[model samples]
Target: MENKRTEISDLGEFGLIDRISQNFTSVNNETELGIGDDAAVLNSLGSRIIVTSDMLLEGVHFDLSFTPLQHLGYKAVAVNVSDVAAMNAIPKQITVNLGLSNRFSVEAVDEFYKGVKAACDNYKVDLIGGDTTSSMSGLVISVTAIGMVGQDKITKRSGAKEKDVICVTGDLGAAFIGLQILEREKQVFMANPDMQPQLDKYDYIVQRQLKPEARMGVVHELAELDIVPSSMIDISDGLASELLHLSRQSGMGMKIYEDKLPIDKQTYDTAVELGIDPTTAALNGGEDYELLFTVSMDDMEKLKKHADIHFIGYVQSSDKGNIMATKGGNEVEVTAQGWSHFKKP
Candidate 1:
């Protein structure tokens, strides 16, 4: 009873971030970007600099179970860039910090770097700096990205207005389902070493979990069409959570249609196979990494024919309430049920 120790799992991930960053204070005025949005924003002469950081852990956020190191490295960077993209900025530089245990070899570390290099090339962001340290447990990778955009062009989660159309890019729920599949496969392998995984049917959902794209492609399309979203957030959380964030910031409620929600055929089929409600997965599943945004009705013409983006609903008066009219013709209030890492097991 004299000596005591506590487990980190008790604090959860976001709690750890809050505890660590609480003691930190803003110093330099030029340190415009810090720890809030997808990235931080710095003030510059003609442009506002953007910054953001993320850490991927071994057992919690990611499982080395069925995931390859290279994809893990690439995904870590893409997740950060998705934040930068959420700000409507272009990524220019990044710093990577790593915590490795002796279990990983020099060759394994090289493979991780190879993935990082691929992401840098894809996003046109440079690998500027970082630190490599030892960890007693498994691998940990933290990335900080810096980008820039004009002050007038900045998009936060705070600009939606009533009547602004709610839009979502790509589909939803694939990544979460993919995680389920991977976990299932891993258990099967552990149960019988000779049992080969029948993964051919789940390849798409599996890749969605392992190799999520940042949707910079959609950003480019929005730019080419000359439309900026009134408010925006990437869907790292569930669609419901991100929608509520935009609503609170804009002082409005939202009205989205369940019939209009986009779920990939593969995702739907697999969700049913796993005995999960496809609608629930689409609503509350996290880490799809697509952009959830609001655009003025006038900008609608620009994206109407576009393939990936869907006009799911519109911002409404908070007095009217945030509700979804299901495909079955019933209305229900939207709620935030994102992956609560603090979730009781």
Candidate 2:
């Protein structure tokens, strides 16, 4: 049977908002008001609130050729939550604004919202409120995540002290490798319409690019263990770039061991297959959504046995400079090569 197609014009703007509003229920008590009103209300959870907003452009931020609507929706919310998690805060609510072109149908919007709703449930955040408007070009998603953290629990990039241990949660470079695979598949399909994408071998990396989770688990674990990171930042623009940001902000230098960088087996093999260095991918690959943080040496023993956390380096005095100790025992100046929005492709 053919699926029914409903146009946005059929339901109109108010009707579409109503349809989307029904799919999400407020999960956070702080979300005193969600949807239906001109504004959403939130009960202050803490003395400090951390707010972060991220915008996703269809062509620049993501390629719809290989991205599913559901995955895109989930990714939109997850990426925003990642920023909040980086501050060592618990995300409470998110407001999603979408600009849709005529090409998007009512069912297409519903499919997108299903993924958003799934992400909200998984992250334990409430969909508060947002605006829906028409667009002349492509689908645009802007998400603002609101989170709360106590003054003492809040983490920043500038808190690192000399000799602080640099730790990273989860493996890196899978997302970049996933993008390579996706682009390769897209080109192959474009060249031949009959060819189907063979992606079983690349499933891990592909999924990493499609649907990434914020490191809220790691944050909760640190709290449970009564361990607070001296500094923290999410690994969105790759390890090397984020490290530079921390160094610059904290007025300190860093020394990271190349051999200590975590890379998944699949990511390593795929990078080699693609004629790219695995270390390069780990350093410069963007969109990992992992957390890179620093803990005082005194607290090292508490997290030393963590299975998911990898100690990659240590903070150094400003005179030492940002450097990476290679596997061959040579130190090289760390460079920032992460994603730059202004760079022309």
* Candidate 2: Cα lDDT at 166: 97
Which pairs clash inside model 1? 32-41, 33-41, 39-51, 39-52, 40-51, 42-49
The TM-score leader among the candidates is 2
Model 2 TM-score (2 dp): 0.98
State the C-alpha lDDT per candidate.
Answer: 0.84, 0.94
Which runs of model 2 end up more than 4 angstroms from their true locations?
none
What is the C-alpha local distance difference test score of candidate 2? 0.94
Displacement of the residue 190 alpha carbon in candidate 2, Å: 0.5
Clashing pairs in 2: none
How does residue 135 of candidate 2 score in lDDT?
97
Q: Please provide, for model 2 over 31-85, each residue's C-alpha lDDT reduced to its tens digit, 9 standing for 90 to 100.
A: 8999988899998865588899999999989998899999999999999999999
lDDT of each residue in 1-345, candidate 1, tens digit only: 114433445455566445433433444344455543455555555678888999899888898879888899889999999999999987776777888776765456656777777787788766655666678999989999877788877899999988999999999999999999999989999999899988899998899899888988888888899999999999997999998899888899999999899999999999999999998898899999999999999998789999999999999999988899998999999999996887898
